[model samples]
Target: MSSFPDYYALLGVTQSATTEEIRQAYKKESLRTHPDRLTKASSAEKKRATEKFQAVADAYYVLSDPTRRSEYDVLYASQPRRSQDPNASSNFFSQFANMFAGAAGGSGAGAGQPGTPPAGQRPDAEGVFSDVFEELLRPEVERRVSWWAYLGAVCGAGVGFIIANIPGLMLGAVAGNRLGAIRDAKGKSVAAVFNQLGGNQKAEILRALAMKVLGSAF
Candidate 1:
């Protein structure tokens, strides 16, 4: 459980570093600490380089965004953090696991009482999922290369699918758009049944719309 790294220190720059300086520092340090460059290093050294690389990425993400950068500039090296409490860590894990399991809809899980999950059980599904999501989604800890590769693959598939079913998709949209004309009780117009789907179905509908919208625009 490491505390947050100093964004300036991680980038090998002073707190007063300008945006250009920060960008240059990230380029330099990222090149040095990249995991690929450490492939020949010992296993421990490789892990250290990976952590360092992640820290540098995190720092750059924070400092590059104007809103977050302003916030960090104001708060950096100035705010006081609570002393690291070993007991708090264990207690937090206990509460977090039960809440997560309940949220995950697992059986036999209580709704997370304070100090619940015993000290012994391995890190629960909740904690691991949260950490993975945080690392993947946090502007400060992006998976730059991996994420772009995934986006490229998905966009490729989307294009292929749109080309294959253009006619059918257009028909569905025409039908959906006409849904507003139908009337229900008390002379009020009820949106066509298709518009009243639950969240999952609504997501499917929006995704279909997105493919069509993008296809036509392009």
Candidate 2:
């Protein structure tokens, strides 16, 4: 056995404990020894609890992964037993600190490397809009528009024109006035209205608006 604290012992689990058992033990130990749980304790007690909590977390991080666990098991088995070293706890903590420092340094280096945009420089608004637009249009583009929709709108307008040419214009003007009043009451812009629509509804509205704009351009 190694002079270092046994991870399994820290978690209160056996060497042959299953992954789920190890996870449960870690969760139980972590909650019990967490610094927050020592709110009423003395300063010394709180500090000790914090250290124990960190150790439990670190142990779980290593033991939960098969590769790391295997490596640790071999290294642990090869070391002198805990009884042989009076300074075993200090030695274990020193090694743990070095391991944590190395991990942090590696993470920082990877995050700051060239060819990757820094966190502050990354595009957010434009990227989100582009993603949303692409997703919304995907189904519409995949499934061709039905001719019946165009035909229905055309026939409805034609019938209205035939029935009362002058009254139809007056009626359209009244409807437009009512819609404007509703929009003003809501205090919502065209973009806000479009955003409130479901995906399919938005796609249809956008397609019609886009076609109207393009048609006027020609």
Candidate 3:
């Protein structure tokens, strides 16, 4: 029998993991395997990371939704055990690739298609994965930078006007935009650092970020 991709194992989660748990697992796995985080890696390593990243995204999308998760759970339960087989890993990924390729309607038809995912299962599979990647890498405070920059410019202008006069408005806008850009850079730096940390360290950082987000929400 062919081996199936173990979504739970891929994300390091249990089959019984809660939705929130699965979400958290995806965040952890996605960050670790993100291709951008492996710029210094060998070509092969980078390719592997990219594939793993896509797989992680696919697993999260499937497991996060109720209906899909239920379906996956059943399939997973029914798949025969091949953990002892050395070929299990390769077989799993082979099927994984084929699954997405089929989703793209096969090689002949999909080859000419632009913006098609390497193993795209659905027309928008790549799009969904992109969204997930963006969400995962986004800085805590910089989630909506465009909106924040606009608001910041307005506020900065108001503050500047009170301090100075006509010239202050223009100065304030430039300053606001500059400050926004700086913060965004800092956020990116933080994410980079987070990516380099050990597993336990990452968990701590993720926990802190989660707490801060939750605190602000309430």
Candidate 4:
């Protein structure tokens, strides 16, 4: 990889670009690099597209947040440009599959080590699900369990108790609460909620989504 990635350059923005400018750049880069746009291309081409797409996303994930952008600006100034590492391109898609595991509150394991998923294997969907919904929505959108969720959980637990006893009751409650939360969140503005979230929280969501998408592509 280039020494420290130039988040601004990656998104085709200047260091002084506003958050809106960075967001617009991200959308444009995402559209251009999204793997779906390369449907008819060779496997290699598609892989390259996916990597570029994820990189663009990574850049935005860092730049869009005020705190992260500030920290990145510090690093950006001190880090000198260097020649690209040929090996960096080989595993561009694998880092998220591994890095986010720990960063997003997962079982501890670094990239390329034991317990990490191989390139083509799917990352932990449960982890990604939790990161997207729980991390992104909890504080910014809503944290309390809604009436719908409570009702669903109660009903689900009752059904489970009738069908399978203690184990089913526990599983049903968890499933019911999840369904209820989804119902409550259906009308919330995700964009507005995202804007209210902190930098690390946003990074958790972005890395989770990136891992899921890139893992699927491979």
Query: Which candidate's TM-score is highest?
Result: 3
lDDT by residue for model 4 (22-49), tens? 7667655564565544445899997776
lDDT of 3 by residue, 14-92 (tens): 8889988887786666656656544457999977766666667667655666655665577678887624232443455
Show where candidate 2 strays beyond 4 Å: 83-90, 93-218
Best by lDDT: 3
Quantify how close model 4 is to the true structure by its C-alpha RMSD in Å: 12.8
- Better structure of 1 and 4 per lDDT: 4
TM-score of candidate 3 against the unseen true structure = 0.48
- Which residue runs does candidate 1 get wrong by more than 4 Å? 1-4, 80-218
Cα TM-score per model = 0.36, 0.41, 0.48, 0.42
From the highest TM-score down, the ranking of the candidates is 3, 4, 2, 1
Question: Of models 1 and 3, which has the larger lDDT?
Answer: 3
Candidate 1 — what's its lDDT?
Answer: 0.42
Global lDDT of model 3: 0.56
* Model 2 / residue 143 / CA error / Å: 44
User: What's the lDDT for candidate 4?
Assistant: 0.54
Candidate 1 C-alpha error for residue 96, in Å: 16
